[model samples]
Target: MDQPQNNPKAYWRENLRYLILLLTLWFLVSFGAGILFKEELNAIKIGGFGLGFWFAQQGAIYVFVVLIFVYVRLMNKLDRKYGYDEEA
Candidate 1:
């Protein structure tokens, strides 16, 4: 049996850290590229459409899906590191 390295508070802090990081990335991709930096990204073209337009319409969704998988994988690793992983 594995024992956790830190107390509940520490565990939660780490969890929140991961959440914040992942959510920040999602927000940056969805909003930053889609809206804030749209003009700059618009200078680039992808498949006959502006890069920012693509990001707003489709790229953000793809990034979000990828982020979901990334978050899950990262959390699984964190859980294992902290001895919170489920028994297989």
Candidate 2:
């Protein structure tokens, strides 16, 4: 039988990077683009959707959903690499 191998440090680092990136994006869209820069973004509008309005209403949600999926994907890959993914 082959023994499973795992690198805790690598796993933690990858997870941390993924989380940080996701949080940064969340902060940027939720706070930066939605509130802080609302006035500046107001100067630009796409069709009937204003920049801040679009970001607050749809873009942020979309990005959040995508980020979750991306995290799941990366975690799955990491698990596989570390022999921790049962589904893999």
Best model per TM-score: 1
TM-score of each: 0.87, 0.81
Q: Which candidate is the best by lDDT?
A: 1
C-alpha lDDT of candidate 2 relative to the true structure: 0.83
lDDT of 1 by residue, 1-88 (tens): 4666646787788889988998899899999999999999999999999999999999999998998899899879877777778953
State, as a TM-score between 0 and 1, how close model 1 is to the true structure: 0.87
RMSD vs true structure, all candidates: 2.3, 3.0
**Residue-by-residue lDDT tens digits, candidate 2, 1-88:** 2533587887788789989988898889988888888888877897777898877778788888988898899888878877788974
Model 1 Cα RMSD, 1 decimal:
2.3
Q: Quick one: how many clashes does candidate 2 have?
A: 0
